[model samples]
Target: MVYTKNKNKNLIGDKVKYARLKNKPKITQNDLLARLAVRGITLEKTAISKIESKTRPVTDKELVAIADALGVSILWLLGRE
Candidate 1:
């Protein structure tokens, strides 16, 4: 299913961008892409950029993988913790 931006959503992409940037050692988009690749999520750098820029929607599986790769809790990524 195609996903579009929803104003009522919890701004997950923004939260993800913040978590990624705030990570220790400062993770880069390419580094994140590589990490996700290791987790079997093959996303292009542009896709990562778009995700970080809040222009793309992150899937549930991607969210889990990203949180794992970033060493963050899913709750944190979801802004619930």
Candidate 2:
């Protein structure tokens, strides 16, 4: 099996952290987890922290869920905005 590593640690980690902190009420990591859960995406708190710290790689599904949860576009998250 060939395993391909990501060129970037994560494309959206910084944006995720920014969106979470920039919300009107400032969404917590736990709150973002709950929102993702509501959308059928399960993730642990540490995972959220890792994602924000750019120590984790995010899947496409997670990206969509995260964008929805943070009320941001995937494009923006990917820094295309």
Candidate 3:
């Protein structure tokens, strides 16, 4: 068995945080969690915080859900836009 550690835990963490805070109403961590839940992606408040803090790795499913919840594109979240 082999494992590779990514240089960065997640590429979209900062962007996710940015998009969330950049919202007109500034979505809080809890709000983001709720949004994700509405999208059928359940995550804890701490998980959201970790994601935003770049300390957690987001799954592809989570990436899509988060992007949708934040009303942003995956490309944008990946810093491609």
Best model per TM-score:
2
How do the residues 1-81 of candidate 2 rate in per-residue lDDT, one tens digit apiece? Answer: 676885556978889999999888999999999999999999877999999888889999999999998888999999998
Least accurate 10 contiguous residues by lDDT in model 2: 1-10
C-alpha RMSD in Å of predicted model 2 compared with the true structure: 4.0
Candidate 2 TM-score to native: 0.88
What are the lDDT figures for the candidates, one per model? 0.80, 0.91, 0.89
Candidate 2 collision pairs: none
Better candidate number, 1 or 3, judged by lDDT: 3
Give the winner by lDDT: 2
Residue 77 alpha-carbon offset, candidate 3, angstroms: 0.4
Off by over 4 Å in 1: 1-10
* Model 2: residue 16 alpha-carbon error in angstroms: 0.5
Compared with the true structure, the alpha-carbon lDDT of candidate 1 equals 0.80
- Better model by TM-score, 2 or 3? 2
Weakest 10 consecutive residues of candidate 3 by summed lDDT: 1-10
